[model samples]
Target: MVALAKEKQKELVEAEKYVSEVYEAIKERNPHEVEFIQAVKEIFDSLVPVLAKHPKYIEHNILERIVDPERFISFRVSWVDDQGKVQVNRGYRVQFNSAIGPYKGGLRFHPSVTPSIIKFLGFEQIFKNSLTGQSIGGAKGGSDFDPKGKSDGEIMRFSQSFMAELGKYIGPDVDVPAGDIGVGAREIGYMFGQYKKMKGAYEAGVLTGKGVSFGGSLARTEATGYGLVYFVDEMLKHKGLSFKDQTVVVSGSGNVSIYAIEKAHELGATVVACSDSNGYIYDKEGIDLDTVKRLKEENSLRISEYVEEHPHAEYKEGCSEIWSIPCDIALPCATQNEIGEPSAKLLVANGVKAVGEGANMPSTLEAIDTFLENDVLFGPAKAANAGGVAVSSFEMAQNSSRVSWTFEEVDAKLKETMASIFTNSIKEAEEHGVPGNLVIGANIAGFKKVADAMIDQGVI
Candidate 1:
C-alpha cells in the first residue's frame, strides 16, 4: 500500500510539472497576449488529470503544437470613408488548428479586436468546434473596426475592403468566416458580395452568416442564444428544476442575448434584464424582446431607449451592474471578462442558481472558481455557446447540397446538438472521475478528439 501511494504521488508531480513547464513556455512566447495566456492556462489546468491518464499526449508534444497557431496573418485595411478620407485599420486571421476539418470561425469587428483577443477566441474555438461533433476546425479573424454610428455606406466599404485582403486566405474548404460582434447580416452581406465578385463565382459556402435569402441557415441567428438556454435547461433538469417560473438576467441586447431572452421566455422564464455596451435595462415586467430588437437591431439605439418606451423599467448607467440584478439564472452574452470575481460573488449572494456563458470566455478564471465554490450550475462557453457554430456547420451542408431546411428543422437540430453536448460533457466528466464538473469534462472531451486527430495526421 505504501509503494502504491508513492507511485501515485510521483505521477501527480510529473503531471503538474509538465503543465507548469508548458504554461511558462507559452507565456514566454506570448508575453503581451494576456487573454490568450489566460485561455491556454484555463484549458491546461483542466487537463492535468487527463495528462496523468493519457501520457501519450505529452509523448507526442501535443501541448506545444496545439498552443501554436498554424498561421498568423496580419494585414492593413484601407478604405475611403464617407468624407473621402482614407481610413486605415488592421486585420488579422489566426488559423489555429485544422486537424479535425477546415478552419471555421467568426470575424469580429469591434474596436477591442487585438491579436491577443483574436488568439484567445481562436484557441477556445478549437475545443468549442470539437464539442459540436461537427466537421469544423478552429480559426478566428477580425479587425479593430468599430461599426457603431457608422453609416451604411461606410460599413459596406469597410467590410468590402476587409474581405478584399481576408478573402485571399479563406474559402469554403480552406477557412470560412462568419459574423461576430460588429460583424452581422449586413456586414456579412457586403463581405460575401466582395468574395463573390473577386472569385467571379458564387461560393455561398465561404461564409456562414450570410442573409437567409442567400445561403444562411434559418436558425443560425438564434442558435447560440437558444442553444445556451437548451444546455442550461438540461443542467437545471439534472437538479430536478426547470426554467419554468424562473427569473433570469441576460447581458447584451445583441443577437445572442436577444434570442436567449426569447428562448428563456418560451421556457416559462421571465428575463428581467439585458444590456448593451453603454448600460443595462431592468424591466420587472419582463424585457420586451420586440422593443429590444427594434432598439438594437432596426433603429440601432442604446439600451437606455427601452425605458422611454416602457416607463416602468429602469436603466442603469454601467454595464457591469447588470450582474447585480438578482435572478435565478445569469447569462453573460456580451463580451470577454465581463464578469469578475466581485460580480460573481454578488450573483452568488443574490441566490443565483445557474450561469450559462453565452459569450466566449465571458467569465474570468477567478469568477469561475467562485461559482464552483458556491455550487452554482456553471455552463462554460465552449459547450453552451456552440449552437451558433453547430448551425453554421449545418448551413455549410445546405450550401454544399443546394437545399435549405425549414426553421423548425434547423432549430430541432440545434436543440439536439446542445443536449448531446451536455450529455457528452457529463459522461466524459464521470469517466474522468470528476462527475458533474462540466468544465474539466468539456475541456477533456473536446481536447481528446483534436489530440487524437493530430496524432493520426502525423506531426504537421
Candidate 2:
C-alpha cells in the first residue's frame, strides 16, 4: 500500500510537471502574446489528468503541434476612405488547425484586434468547433480597421480591398469566414461581392453570415445568444432548476445579447440588464428587447439611451459593473476579459446561480477559478458560445446544397445541437472523475477528438 501511494504521488507530480513544461515553452515562443498565452494555459491546465490517462498524446507530440498554427497569413489592406484618402490596415488569417475539416471561424473587425487576440480566438475555435460534432476545424481572421464611424462606402471599399487579398487564401472547401464583432451583414455583403467578382463565380460556401437572400442561414443572428440560453437551460434543468422566475443579467446590446435576451424571455426568465461599451441599463420590469434593438441596430446609439425611454430603469456608468447587479444568471456577451476576479466574486456574492459565456474568453483565468471554486454552474465559452460557428457551419451546408432551411427548422436544429453539447460535456466530466466540472469535461471532450484526428493524419 505504501509503494502504490508513492507511485501515485510520483505520477501526479510528473503530470503537473509535463503540462507546466509545455506551457512554459508556449510562453517562451510567443513572449509578447499575453492573451494567447492565457488561453493556452487555461486549456493546458485541464489536460494534465488526461495526459496521464493517455500517454499516446505525449508520444505523438500532439500538444506541441496543436499549439502552433498550421498557417498564419498576414497582409496589408489599403482602401480609399470616403475622404478619398488611402488608409492602410493590417489584416490576418490564422489557419490554426484543419485536421477535422477545413478551417472555420469568424472575421473580427475591431480596433483592438491584434495578432495575439486573433490567435487566442483561433485557438479557442479549434475546440469550440470540435464540440459541435461538425466537420470544421478552426481558424480566425480579422483586422485593426475600426468600423465604428466609417461610412458605408468606406466600409465597402475596405471590405473589398480586404477580400481582394484574403480571397487568394480561402475557398468553399479550403476555409470559411463569418461576421464577428464589427463585421456584420453589410461588411459580409461587401466582402462576398468582392470574392464573387474576383473568382467570377458564386461560391457561397466560402463565407458564412452572408445576407439571407444571398446565402446566409436563417436564425444565424440568434444562434449564439439563443444557443447560450439553451445550454444554460439544460444546466439549470440538470439541477432541478429552470429559467422560470429567474432574474438574468446579460452584457452587451449586440446580436448575441439581444437574441439571448429574447430567448431568456421565451424561457420565462426576466433579463433585467443589458449593456454596451459605454454603460449598462438595469430594467427591473425586464429589458425591452425591441427598444434595445432599435437603439443599437437601427439608431446606432449608446446604451444610455435605454433609460430615456424607460423612466423607471437605472443606467449605470461603468460596463463591468453590470455583474454587481445580482441575478440568477450572468451572461457576459461583451468582450474578452470583461469579467475579472473581483467581478466574478461580486456575482457569487450576489447569488448568481449560473454563468454562460456568450463572448469568447470573456472571463479572466482568475475569474473562472472563482466561479468553479464557488460551485457556480460555469459554462466555459467554447462550449457555451459555440452556437454561432455551429450555425455558420449549417450555413455552409445550406450553401453547398444550394437550399436554405426555414427559420423554425434552423432554430430547432440549434436547440438540438446545444443539448447535445451539454450532454457530451457532462458525460466527459463524469467519466474523467471531475463530475459537474464542465470546464474539464469540455476541454477533454474537445481535445480528445482533435488529438485523435491529428494522430491519425500523421502530423502534418
Candidate 3:
C-alpha cells in the first residue's frame, strides 16, 4: 500500500508539472483567486491518467478554455429597507461552463459571497452536474447581501433588486438558478416574481426551489441532505457497516444540514452535533430535530440556542471546535474549506469511519488526503451533495411539462438518482484502477463526458 501510494504521489507531481504553464497563467491572469485556484488544483492533479487516455483534450485546449468562464457579470443591487433606508450590494454571476446543457447552479445570498467563491463553486458545479447523469451545465451567481436579522420586506426588496439585473442574463433555456446558503424558497419566490415582472412572462422554469403551489417540486428542500446520506449509506454498506446506531457530527444548521440530520436520524444514526455561524451544539442524546428546526428555520436563531432547550447538550462558542467531538461520521455541511488538516486529524483520531461533504469543497486537499490515508470513507461534494441539483433538474422538467408530480414520485426518483451517482462514481473509480477513491473517479468520470462533448462540438 505504501509503494502504491508513493507511485500515486509521483504521478500527481508529474501531473502538476505537466499543467504548470496553464496553471501559472491562470494565477497570473486572476491574481489572489485562492478558492478558484484550490478547486482547479484538486481536479488537475487527478487528470494525469485521463489526459493520457484522451490526448485530444489537451490538443484541443479544453483545460485552458474550461478554466475561464464563458461569461462573467457583476452589478450593483440597490434596494429600500423597511425603515425607508436605501441600501446597495454587489451581485455577481459566473456562467462558468456549458459543454453539456444549459447553465445550472445556485444563487447564494450571504455576506461572504465573492467572485472567487462563486467561480470555485461554478467550476465544481460543472463536474457535479456532469456526474448526476443530467444534461445541465454549470454556472453560479450570488451577492454580498446578508439576510440575517432582516425583515421579510427587506429580504423581498433585496431579492427583487438582485433579480432585476440578473433576470436579463438568465432564462429557462439559458441559466437556471436555485437556492444556496442564505437563499431559499422565500428568496427564490421574490426573485422569480421580479423576473416575471421584468420579462412580462410567467416562466416558472426560469428558477427552481420555488413554492410547490407554483412550480417547485416536492422533496427539493430535503434532496441535498438526504442525497448525502444515501450516498454515504452506499459507502458504508460496501464496507460492511451501516448508519444504524452510528454517532454522527453534522456542521451547520442550514436547510442542507437540517434535513441531513432528519434523514440520518430516520436511518437510525444519532446526529450528536450541529453548528451555525456563531457556534455549535453537541447533544449527547442526539440532536432534537424539532428544537433545531424551530431555532434555525422557523426563528432564524444561532445554533447556540439549541442548548437552551436541551439541558444536557453543550454549546461551544466557536464552530471550528465542533470537529474535536468524537463521532463515527463527520458531515461538514457548512461553508467551503471548513475542515482543514487539523479538523481532519481530530476526526481521524476519534475513529471517524467516514466523511461526507454536504457543502461544496468543505474539506481542504490536505484534509482529504489525511482522511484517505487513514482509510476513512470520503464522499466528495460533487457526488454526495448533488441531490439538490438533481431535484432542481426534476423541477425544471416538471415546469417544462406543465405538471407537478406527487412528493412520493419526486422523492423516489431522487433516491434512484443518488444511487445511480454512487454506482457511477464507484464504477469509474474501479475502471480507472483507483478503487475506492471517489475523488479521482468522480473527476475523471465527469471530465470525460464534458471533454468528449466539447471535442465533438468542434471548438465553439
Provide the lDDT at 382 for model 2: 97
| Deviation in Å, model 1, residue 228 alpha carbon | 0.5
Candidate 3 residue spans exceeding 4 A from truth: 1-16
Per-residue CA lDDT of model 1 for 1-460, tens digit only, reads 9999798778778888999999999999999999999999999998888887888998998999999999999999999999999999999999999999999999999888999999999999999999999989999999999998899999999999999999999999999998888888999999999999999999999999889999989989999999999999999999899999999999999999999999999999999999998999999999999999999889888999999999999999989999999999999999999999999999999999999999999999999999999999999999999999999999999999999999999999999999999999999889877888899989999999999999999988
Question: What lDDT tens digits, residue by residue, belong to model 2 across residues 12-81?
Answer: 6777787888889999999999999999999998887688778788888889899999999999999998
Model 3: per-residue Cα lDDT at residue 349: 96
Candidates' lDDT values, in order? Answer: 0.94, 0.94, 0.91
lDDT leaderboard ranking: 1, 2, 3
| Candidate 1 vs candidate 2, lDDT winner | 1
Which pairs, if any, clash in model 1? none
Model 3 per-residue lDDT at 2: 100
> What ranges in model 2 sit over 4 Å off?
1-9
Instruction: Give the per-residue lDDT of model 3 (tens digit) for 1-460.
Output: 9998887777656555667778888889989889999999898877776775556777888889888999999999999998899999999999988889999999999998889999999999999999889999999989999998899999999999999899989999999999998899999999999999999999999999999999999999999999999999988998999999999999999889999999999999999999988888989998999999999888877888777778899998888999999999999999899999999999999999999999999999999999999999999999999999999999999999999999889888988988888888888888777899989888998888998888888877
Which 10-residue window of candidate 2 scores lowest in summed lDDT?
A: 7-16
Candidate 3 local distance difference test against the native: 0.91
- In the predicted model 3, the residue pairs found to clash are none
Give the winner by lDDT: 1
